[model samples]
Target: MHSFKRVLVTGADGFIGSHLTETLVRAGYNVRAFVYYNSFNSWGWLDQSPEEIKRELDVFAGDIRDPHGVRSAMQGCDAVLHLASLIAIPYSYHSPDTYVDTNIKGTLNVLQAAKELGVAKIVHTSTSEVYGTAQYVPIDERHPLQGQSPYSASKIGADQMALAFYRSFGLPVGIIRPFNTYGPRQSARAVIPTIITQLAQGNRKIKLGAIHPTRDFNYVEDTVEGFISFLESSRSIGEEINIGSNFEISIGDTARLIARLMNVELEIETDEIRLRPEKSEVERLWADNRKARELLNWQPAYGGEKGFEAGLAKTIEWFSNPDNLLNYKANLYNI
Candidate 1:
């Protein structure tokens, strides 16, 4: 296993990033959390993490888009888990330029910095959205990438950039592509959170878009575990691996499932404003996790028949808390 004492987690303030950061700290690793600089000094979900994790963390606030800032934060770190990217698909449609600058350019900054810093290994985050509407079921690393939306297109560019650095410069990098990771701390813009928050706010009629599309949902813990597996294994260098539950469910069904778990009967409303452009909607995604198993010795523990149901129970518990539910604006359509 590759060993690194000090690791930098870019985007460490976000949902998955915060969980990964906390997990690493608990496992006795020196974690440097590079959060996006904001005047409010917000660390996103990291702010709500246990105080013990916060005490030991070296939090560096900086923008991923700034090469100088990235380099400054990365200095002395052995490895970087770059998860900083603009990911809202609907927002991307309205502002593709911001996605390009943040996702593409921000990725470039990390790659160039890692090369210069001589980092031992870097885990570059990718998304299953890059394989738009999955041409084949059980989408593997070999699946053709389709840029169906601006978000996926920017991620495709970033993924290619990471690969180019690996192939051309021989940078030790692994691309971890996760499918629809959902759990506590996920923003309201996400489907699961939107559904949960709406129910928590006593909305009997849930508003959603493009309910026909199917997704492979992997819990946040499972997704973070995949990153650690790659970080510890040298076999994954210069390769792209998938981290996902090898199962599929339509969006509408997922909403209904969450409702059942929360014990809330609801009407599903199709909000036209919430729907993606018809041509841009991804129809389906089901992960072929064989490569992750073969290469990283990883399989999702939170997947299969009862995995999603169990995960939803945990997520519902989190969102049901008045403290957690208050942070969300359930009445407003997020993004």
Candidate 2:
């Protein structure tokens, strides 16, 4: 195991990043959170983190697309968890150029800086969307990448860049390709949050798209643990490992499950605007996390049907809270 003195988390302001940051701090790791710089000075989800966690953070506000700012953020950090990127698929369709700039170019900035600084470890985040529709069940790292959408394409580029850095300059870089991750602080653009938020608001008709598509949903806590495992293991260097629950469920079933858990009867309405281009829609995803288990000795605490239900129950509890539910505009389409 490689010990890192200080870890820089790009996108530390995001949903998964925020959870990872708090977990790392609780585990006694020095974390420098690199948040997107905005005039509003919003630290994103970090703004809502506990006081103790915030007090322990060394927060730096900067844009990942800016090379100088990215380099500056890496100066004192021995390791980096590069999670900053534009992730919304529908938004990517509307703005492909921004996706290339933020996801690809931004990742390049992180790689270049990590190479120069001789960073001990760097884990770049990848999404299961990169696999597109599963041509085969239980996708492994060896699965062929099919970037059906602009968002997935940009991530594919980023993943290659990270691997290139490792191959060419001998930089210690690893990629953790997580399947669908959901939990508190997740944006309504995600399916689970969309369902939960709409229901919490007492909406009888749930708006969704392509409900037949299956996803391997990993809870935020499980995803965070996967990141930590990758960060600590030297065996993960130059490896692209999957972090996911090895279980699949269609979007329609997931919605029904949520409604059942929430104890509300509802009907799913296919929102035309929510539908992706038929060619761009990924119809299935199931994770084969054997690589993560063997290399990093990691597995999701929330795995399979029962585990998914448990995760969903916890998620529902959080989203059901009036204070949290008020933060979401459930009636509006998020993307």
Local distance difference test scores for all models = 0.93, 0.94
TM-scores, all candidates, are 0.98, 0.99
Question: lDDT per residue, candidate 1, 220-332, as tens digits?
Answer: 99999999998998799989999999999999999989988888897999999999888899999999999999999999888995999998899999999999998899888
- Alpha-carbon RMSD to native, per candidate: 1.0, 0.9
Give the poorly placed runs of model 2, Cα more than 4 Å off.
none
How many clashes does the backbone of model 1 have? Answer: 0
lDDT for 26 (candidate 1):
91
- Cα deviation at 290, candidate 1, in Å, is 0.5
TM-score of 1: 0.98
Worst 10 residues of 2 by lDDT: 1-10
